[model samples]
Target: MSSMTAPHPIDDQWDRFRSTLADASQLLLCLDFDGTLAPIVEEPDEASPTPENEAALASLVSASAVSTAIVSGRALADVRDRIDGPKTYAGNHGLELSRHGLVAVHPVARKRTSRLEAVCTALETVLEPVPNCRIENKRLTGTVHVRSVPRRLRPVVRRHTHAVVDRFGNDALEVSTGKRIFEIGPSIPWGKGNAVALIAADLPSETVPIYIGDDVTDESAFRIVEPDGIGIRVGGDEPSAASCRVESPTEVATVLDWLGSVGVDLLESDTSELSSVDTSSFE
Candidate 1:
């Protein structure tokens, strides 16, 4: 596994990252909710962004050169409600997206909602006897969380979860593992990478894409932005396409705070330049 030293405010590495963003005509700042913006918690519903993090995001959103979006595994409305802002949101692992009063759902994913729900039901029943296993119904997808399950019983949990998913046939649905959780979603080519690509397609040609996340699912997005953009992994030494790393959500906030400050300065500079433009010729 590749590892990076913990990021600090005065780190030269962070300064270089800021320099990249400083020259971009537009910045597409994509973030993951659970582990990137907020610390991972025992209860998914209890996770919320800190005040400092929220302030940073607010500044980024208000910046003329930046477009902020939250791409999360939670349901679109659920994550949107948790973060108090009017930025873009891609939820359900990007199976669903909402931006600027417009919403889009993958047709293929929509078709499997019923099957996913059925799988969720079967997994719930099959794993009910297992302690500390929680079934999260994400509408278009479902997750069997084993983080709190006894380590010895995790194998059994995985077995049962796999059995339930396999019963639906591999073509009907697929299972993906993350941290200590298993997710059941449609067996489609779409993922966070596809979602980020879709979002980036609408931005200016000079826009620089930046994705921050921590999970197996986020690897897809990291690969998507590689070679051309920045991907910052939060709290994991596992092999990943992300080029940089931050120790925890606190460091993630520090990064955001820095980006926000730079974005604000850029916006102000643009305003000042416009104010100085000689408009006398137009009159």
Candidate 2:
């Protein structure tokens, strides 16, 4: 599907979102960790949510009717440890998921771990000469970070990284790019959308899903949530499946602040100003 030509700013539609929030019985809030909850850093290991954002997340998590999940490209444990409030975490673009005392790994991706590791090993050797490149092997997936590489040499990194993955991947893995990184994971239909849909399935049928993210990888979830739920894109004006947009992670924190505060009031309130809006449309 095509993205909106000019998505409305999130604040402009905050009233509409509140209307939906009031109509729904539960809220499923899905967020992308890096670049959404936290600022994008050159060193991924140092990334963490701002205190304001983390506190807001904790506020949302404290509500029984609100279920929060962190979906990211990092490993499941990696993203899970980065944030403390979300009860659910989906990582490696949904190849691995943990929620409700249950953990699931895509069977195909799990089986390809050896091949993924091999490809990462090859990528490390091939990309070594490239300055500021980082290769990560996340068991079920791999990534080549070129965010800090010299702009002139980025194409070289892409070419070399692709060649290595193609040569050793042997049809077992596929490559996708987002923000300045190459994601090498199992060749499957699974993605952030599928993971989100799966997680939503476990929530109450009346739950309204709201996904906020800032990268290309998060687009899949945007597509999934746009039909009946809310899809908010962070930091870009580019065409996106997301219907709402914000300026940056700082703004995202503001949205969370409103969500955590206004959300509690709406969910707990007995009346809604827009109650006449067709609730059937949400189904």
Across 1-283, the per-residue lDDT of candidate 2 in tens digits comes to 5356656798799888888888887789999999999999999999999898898899889976788999999899888888997878999899888976778889999889999989999888888999999999999988899999999999998898779878988887888988989889888888999999988887666678999999888888999888688898987688888989998888888888888778757774433433544634333
lDDT score, candidate 1, position 257: 85
Question: By TM-score, who's the top model here?
Answer: 2
* lDDT (C-alpha, whole model) for all candidates: 0.80, 0.86
* Residue 28, candidate 2: C-alpha displacement in angstroms: 0.5
Per-residue C-alpha lDDT of model 1 across residues 8-117, encoded as one tens digit per residue: 22244666576666666677889998887888888887999877788888888877678788998999989998886646889999999997577899998888888888
- The list of candidate 1 runs beyond 4 A from truth reads 1-12, 263-283
**Ten-residue segment with the worst summed lDDT in candidate 1?**
1-10
List clashing residue pairs in candidate 2: none
Q: How close is candidate 2 to the true structure, as a TM-score?
A: 0.92
Off by over 4 Å in 2: 1-4, 268-283
Candidate 2 Cα deviation (angstroms), residue 123:
1.0
